[model samples]
Target chain A: MSSHAGSVQAGQIQRHKLVDRLYHWVMAVCILTLLATSLLPIIGWKFAWLAIHWVTGLVLTVAVLFHIVRALFFQKPMSMVVDGQDLQNLGSGGRPGKYNLAQKLYHLAIAVLILSGIASGLVMLRKIDTPWWRRDPYWFSDSSWGVIYSAHDFVAMSLVTMIIIHVYFALRPDEWHLTRSMFRGWITPKEYKDHFDPKRWNAEEEA
Target chain B: MIVKDIMAPFELYQPAQLKDAFSLLDSFGKDAWKMAGGYDSLDWFKDRIVRPQAVIDLTGIAEMKGIKETPDGVEIGALTTLSEIENNPIIKAKYRLLADAVSHVASPQIRNHGTIGGNASQNARCLYFRYGLPCYRAGGNTCFADTPEGINREHALFGADRCVAVTSSDGAPALTALDAKFVLQSSSGQRVIGAEEFFVGPNVDILHLTAAKPEEILTTIRLPSAWAGKNFYFEKVADRNVWDFPLVNVAAAISVQNGAIRESRIVVGGVSAVPHRLTQVEGIIQGKALEEGTATLAGQSSTRDARPLNYNGFKIPLMASLVTRAVRNATA
Candidate 1:
């Protein structure tokens, strides 16, 4: 957040700053575009979807790599990982933290999808023409290429499903404030109380 | 920490005295809820289960916040922090079973905020009810955990209605074993109910755990003197040490003379909506001279009648192990 992004008098906590918000929206657009381009051609719409799909996938891969670096050093990253306590809290109705169990689980899903997509997508790139190189269709054996393609296809399907579920929860009326916070950078006192346990989140407690 | 409200907006009342509190309760009627430490009420408010017109904050009544001794036994205020109960010298020395049970509740932070009365009065920890999923406890006719579709491992082994989910309070079994009585007060009058009878069992009310009326308030809990000097044991089986409700919790207090057992009171929590008292096991041990191997025999004797769901069949042996451990430790 910038210096003026949050103030003590507002009784609000800065959840996401301008940089994080920008990265989030850009990644969302790229993923949505990638999905549309990949799926539309299969459903029989005829356009140059391959070029667009691979480009967007590459962009997403780079963005994720940047995200990993930023999170490791500059961001609050530990909250995104599911710990031993979280697995038990699933059945026990434990209290919420800064990022909830659902958020941590979603992060796990995204990490799996994006990392798999990137690795397999990189392997498949040898089959296609790129700006840097010409297409070498026989770069790998038939069986190895088949395995890479299968993995890429499976991740694409899972990503679609995960995005659908994510959209459903992110748009819920009570959770609207969560989406708003991502856009606006700060949350109301009531929103903070609704979503995060202050003692655990260790955010602005006075709110 | 209370969840931010999702229900209809409510008026908050902080009445200074018991008289003012009762009048607030009477006025609000079914639209009123009495909140002490608010560990339970906050979840209710967030889930939109109890949309109150006015939430009567009972912590304001200074009278309902302490532990004291009487000629008969000890009285614990409804608003008394579980940390206070767990660490209080009087409770640690006299009511070891209750203290032990309180110490295992969730974590230190939760114990600091959760009250003894609030722990008892809350609803069952059914994921269906908590998430407003399709189930009878969620006000629908369907019993999710009763069917093969829902996960039943955490459900009840005894006293199960259509909803098989169990109560999650660790404080309950110890209170029941110690023969505690919950004191209830309303504008009409005051009444005391035994701890076992305080919670509404399966056949009685499937949705709620307590039988208290909407306007009634749980004022204090009274522990009798008879069990104060007895040997006590508390054992809980949970996945983690902190911030997890017990998979099975056992509390037992036995009177042993020399090597022979004279009387026994055993209660188990988290396996059912109501704390299940193992009277048959208690009966079996009353006459026997307890030894190292007696606990193993008693453990096998307990599962003679347990009816577990498909996934919760493992709880039968788990319950036995916990009971055996509790009984063995009680004698030791």
Candidate 2:
């Protein structure tokens, strides 16, 4: 598209890059699998959920760690933050930079949930008989195990509601442009202009 | 918010020269639309608001894309992007009000892509008109925005268009205050119209915000030397600090010497079909020492002629304070 323009530069702006999209989809799939494997057995549809859930949770943890590295180094990390402009723009039609306030809140919530689930699950590894670790359920006392299990269970349950909201927004017709942008890495110019403020987002050089 | 998935294929008329542009426009007439920077015309096309048979791309015409100091004053080509006008040292040093307003235009990308001509001649800001309402601006008789249930907090306080949509161009008020003139051209010859007269009332019923004929193109904007090197104040009070259209914006170029006001040009946008100049408010403060209360009084007097709708009464005070603030700034 850039090559086609003789004098006028084309206006299709690049939003998300390849790494961001890949990390997002990988984390999405892993989280869904983990949620299903953990929650499906409560309704009696049981089929070795522990192994699948633990493996998916570990994969999600790794993916999230990779995403953190990428977000910090490769992509624009500042877009995920809440700054002076966000607070100053509390009311009015002012658009947040790259990510809006709601999106930032969602990211913060998911980060907390994921970190808590992983930290607590790592402690509960002593209760499981894995190849690397022996089944030393006695290593931590019942009270300790109860604390770890409680934290893990609470976050795991909270994610069910969180993911529902995420999925609902991702599929909503009004939000289809945003979801499509995640895959294509670009939004229609109209959507980008109408929703995002280029002054804050700084998507283009002169804009 | 494209109502269509793909743009309707049209003949892309890339006119590299003025002669070719005129010929192509003359040939296509109403079916051809002049595209400057493609930010405004493309938006209309992408939104399916207009389906042109041919789009006369003006970016390739190199002669029509620069700012130069003419004998009288500065002459900016119509295709000059807002970024160019906003950053050009000449415009900043001379037309500072225009530069200030240009900087706050719809986001940065739009500033880069939207041209001065496109910004000035773009469509009205009526939400109903854009939503396919059969309003007068949409070439229909009904005024949906004036209805009780219609959202009209930003509708015009003047030019009672059955449409009530005000001119949304941010640069217009500054130009109107500066006494700029638009140089329009067709195949036959070129004509000049004052910035104040370039914008017409809603009685025209054209599906546009300006008085440019369908065949004619705005080629250049010529500013008078009167307002050059003058003290000016530009203020835009949008819902956001940036990236939003103005709820009400004011531009004032007041010549004050020895703490006494001599000449003042106060023009406001987002309040009317055209950038309405506040002659009454200008008169209130003209030749008067702008003491602490004088600017406030001028500001308070700004709402004298405002005929606001049900939901837009806030604009009266908003315009007043903004006018007052602009006067204060100019005085300061």
Candidate 3:
């Protein structure tokens, strides 16, 4: 049996090279680790997880900042944003994009969650005279970091929800290859043609 | 690393010429499948449902490319990407319905890669096939969709017998309604099948939906110039606004004379195994002023043949409503 059934032309597009794949997987692990650590405090797990959470949060904050800077400086920003063609597809009923409809939505959601988590974590730190982090010790007696803590929990919950959906879809058999595509870098030529460029084969045939 | 282990084994053949490609298809037959944009094909292959021995890559062939305006009609090479078609000025002005249909296929990236031929030849996006389950359509012993009750909503309203997968391709209905011809090439020779006859029914073979033989390649699509003056429209309803296939879609091309319907063609996709051409409904509207009563009657006639599935009974009324809306829009 041939694997190319239902695919368009033969040559595959190298979406993510080996270096990109390593970066993506490493980033996934770091994000997951951060989520787990942050969730402990919100769901009332033992406070020990708080120590681990803070450590991972610090690591994740640095990593995210690095990623943002790298993407801005090295990667093409146009690829991430919804383009004119994307709007056309949304209007018609076409396939979304490389990241696709769900992926794009999730990307934005996670970015917001990460930013909120870091911002709130920074504010909760005592001796930091940041504008939003300012807290009068007497106002909230039991919890000096009440507002910051609550904001952190809320963003954490939202991040968890988004991650759950993302993982669920990723693990689903129908979408298994889509998740795998990140790791493999090279999808089957068939997949590259259908999902990426129909004309790839067309020009080949003509030549 | 884990993903590479699961990758299926296959040989890729890139034929730099249409003649060479046709010869390959002739030799390989069903064992060799053609790859277009890889959008639909790759997804199906990944699911392990469709496995061909060799993929005949048409991308390298020069003869299979290009979109040009001939004196007779517009010649759209089968490999013309949806994005190209959407941006083509001649197509935009002459056959807006074709442009409209291509515009709604998947996403910008998908449009960039997906070809018109691939879209037209795409298989039914049935739940059973998509989920990797064996059903009657896939040559299994049982019809999972059929039960003690006998008929289901997803079953074909017109030509279904054993299987009831909907024709999920968006381009067919619009092109069919606009009166297009598909130019097919094979090692034996070349032939043209009207867009209407391109899709076969269960009556021919319950397992297959298209009339094209495995050895045959769809080369070019030819659309009549007469359709230029006709008003065209396509509408689809889905679960959400983005990334969902149509629950039901309607495409209409009509010519009105003196405030009455002169000639009209209406087709519905996502509701049946093939583009269900509403000839009876078209007949009803001919020479009549397309008013609310006429539109409602036309809509009622459209679904007279529908054989709704267990989960898709809503399609009957939904199809009726769509036809009504299409008629109203064409007239207005």
Model 3 lDDT per residue over A1-207, tens place: 234533223465546555556666776787777677655533433223434555666777777787788768876554567667667777886654455655666777778887988887765543222235432233333344556667877887787778789889989987766766666655666665566544322323322
Poorest lDDT segment (10 consecutive residues) of candidate 2 chain A: A1-10
lDDT of 2 by residue, B141-181 (tens): 35667665779998888756345788877899999999999
- Measured with C-alpha atoms, the lDDT of residue B282 in candidate 1 is 89
Q: A64-106 in candidate 2: lDDT tens per residue?
A: 8898898888777888887888877886768767888888989
Per-candidate clash tally: 0, 2, 43
lDDT of 3 by residue, B131-237 (tens): 66556567543344544344444445555545567787778898899888899888889899897678766444446567677778899998888787577778877
Clashing residue pairs, backbone N/CA/C < 3 A, model 1: none
Root-mean-square deviation per candidate? 26.6, 29.0, 28.9
Docking class of 1: incorrect
Query: Lowest summed-lDDT stretch of 10 residues in model 2 chain B?
Result: B200-209
Higher-ranked by TM-score: 1 or 3? 1
Candidate 1 chain B least-lDDT 10 residues: B139-148
Candidate 2: RMSD over Cα atoms? 29.0
